[model samples]
Target: MKLKNGKMRKMMTVSLAATMALGLLAGCSGAKTPVSNQEKVLRIGVLYGGNMDDSYFRQQYTDIYEFDRKNVKIEIVPAINQSDWRYNDGSEPYKEPDYLDGMKKIMTGSNPVDVVVTDVSVLKQLIQENMLKQLDPLVQEDKFDTSDFVPAVIDGIKDLGEGSLYALTPSFSSSALFYNKKLLSDAGVEPPTDKMTWDDVFNLAKRLAKGSGKDRVYGFSFNRYMGNDPFWDMQYTYMAPLQLRMYDEKAETMTVESPQWIKAWDTISNLVKEEVIPNNNNVNYDENWTPISNDMFLSGKVAMMISESYYINEIADANTNAAKIKDYTPVDWDVVTLPTHPEKPDIGGNIYLNNTFAINTNAPNPESAWDYIKFIAGEDWAKLKSRSNSYEMVARKSYIQPRQGLSYNIGAFYNIKPVPPTNPKDDKLKQEKRGLYYVENLGRTYFQEVLDKKKSSTEALKDWSEKGNKMLQEIKLNPKTEFQEDGTPYIPEDNVSAAAGLSSKG
Candidate 1:
């Protein structure tokens, strides 16, 4: 598929959380491979999108399950047309999939689809629609062992089912607060602890950030992928955990003029002004005005950052290439649970489960489907998949370990629980008025105005709310109205402020 410049990169970055497959299947010597009464075809449904093909799906399941051993055949059913449900970030407006009808057709017949696999978002929808069979009865009957699974993964899935087990996932993706041990020690600051509040981290950042231009060290970065678009950066990372509301209950009006919104904007702008966090000013543009580098965290110049498991690969790769590159230092880092809101201290907003599996309620071979689910979510699968350097975290807690010769707080990835899904209302609004999705982008411009000191935080939000309300009205009246910002269209890029002196060149 053809994409505009930078669109491919952005799409990949946005889908990073959803990209990794369960990617594992393991063989056991003493395992009793369950079989159907006859040689029945175990039809497996995958939430399909992007370029993932049926062959890839076959490899993911067939290799591990050893269907031939059980006299079974594998068939892949694409449950949805676009797997955009995987995009949990609000960057794109939610598009409710019509998979419910598709699900009915595939899941309700004498020879119905046996298994369904999907991300947690669609898993919730499947459960609510009664398309999935609760696994509790199967677990009890088979005496399936689940004690080795990560508490967060098992508990989070149960929470989705309101204290029931409707599905099981082999792996999860989550963000953790990683800090440079030496940087904090050298700066005479205490290392950040697990579950630190955003305010706590920001205060420490204020203390640790020091020096001017070239030699300056930043205290914290929300993520290593901070872009030149401050409004998008703030909205995507910093403000997201706060759960700031962008629209009313009906999503037909703006809701950003509240005191809470003003406080959030002020807090973000103040951090930028104080240089406690990396902003556009921290980056260097080349002669042609192209961004060169923004990975200050990797250069050992940023004290702390919030990133997912994929970043570990980047860091390892950077370290291996450090000697070949100029003036680079290998970073000594460890991670802890991501910062939490004071009111919701146990919640981690960055946790995601993308490889969930469940049996169809009307499966032709429920026993065989149960066997497949257990095989994937079992300990052997985690053990094998964990050894790979994939950007996903295995659900079995015991299998998770540090890099071969390294030791760090690996528990940080799964210790904190995920924030509950909040897309039901948003989904309803999107179906009613598709244009309501563009309202948040409008706020980005006003937010940048506050950051640039062109407008007071309160005034900026008030103006933003006025404009947003007007746009929502237009969208409600004419659902096809296009949103046009006053200035240039913002194209978000993957650039962050790097350490000014840590040149990529030798």
Candidate 2:
């Protein structure tokens, strides 16, 4: 549930602008005095970097919040477009912006930004650089009541700020373990509960799986939209929760051959061999089924799945169109917290904070910026935003309810603590090795061999590690080096500068 900026920010764009305005004039303790005592301008920086046209922002801003604009002005500081805000799906090559570099330029130069509207990734970076003002003092000064905030979100941010608070987010995204009540009841299998381990979930899946051919029911699917590679989908959920990594702490060696990883591979492989989970080859898709109709759980072919809260909207839409699809009816489903590991009970890996707001340490109008952060994070704002279809869960829990007439568990989305930070420096390592994530794709092939019994988990992992180490060494020797299918170095013939004596491929 890492925040997809494009998808999540669309919901917050205008309203977020409004929050900035209302808070701007409400608290002016640090506000600069106007030459005529008539007006003061509040400068806001859209940190995630999308187009922030002034007229459009003002229109939406005024529509959401009412305040005396007679003596105050709202201005959006220009931001260089950071990335493609339109395409969140991984269909295009993503360009990672140097946010620290950009913020350094924006905040230090003339007419610097006073407030920032950003996501958690940038918020963490800003806090690390000590460029953002701590909000704890302001919270106490204003007597801001944070009691209603989703505990996991507040706690996670505090953990990042090293026992202090640096930012506030109004909404977050999370996943839950959704089960088909009808399937479980019909099969006489117990439904899943919060904090179950991988073993517990797989065993439950086994009991619910039945039939063969077109009627075959799998016990579980990692995601409803697992297209061609269900194996990868299943592995990602288990891998993160279990704290598996492709490389060791230093990124110099692969860790796939370790006992922890070997056990994980064995667990997934055993389940696939037992027909409890569906792989790419085994999932049944009818030719007559529409694109959305291919969802296993929606079609009643899977008993359970773990997916984000937005998935509920898809379920609702399917129910609305149930009559249009032949031989298909709406699913009877409810959700619980995503399954946890026995070693890390009650800590789930599927929570994300988005649209977080923070004031710059060098803010020209610190008091006004603080007001905006407090206003948007307040209960009143949460109530207004919760009524929209914009977010999966608002940070304020009192406003996070199940859809109008539904009775399913809404608390499942935020009932567990987030997986605590494994290491403070892991973020840097992740950034450095972002390009090396291709190893996951490479491991997918060997994992399939393990599933087919062509090799044991131990043997498959050994081979994956050997090949992975080769790829790492190749990248280390020549950063631009690309690999051949067998994991040997292959430099393109035209790129002679990066050849580094490796075999050239046309």
> Which candidate's lDDT is highest?
2
What's model 1's lDDT at 4?
10
Question: Please, what is the TM-score per model?
Answer: 0.82, 0.84
lDDT tens digits, residue span 203-290, model 2 = 8998988899878888987877535364566555676666677787766688888888888888888877877877777776777757
Candidate 2 Cα outliers beyond 4 Å, as residue runs = 1-38, 51-95, 226-231, 420-435, 492-506
Off by over 4 Å in 1: 1-31, 35-37, 49-52, 81-112, 226-228, 285-292, 424-432, 487-506
> lDDT per residue, candidate 1, 177-294, as tens digits?
9899889999899998887888898888888898776567888887775354556666655566566778877767788888778877898788887878777766432222112145
Candidate 1 lDDT (Cα, whole model)?
A: 0.69
> Which 10 consecutive positions of candidate 2 have the poorest summed lDDT?
26-35
Best by TM-score: 2
**Pairs in steric clash, model 1:** 294-496
Residue-level error in angstroms, candidate 1, position 185: 2.0
Q: Candidate 1: lDDT of 197?
A: 82
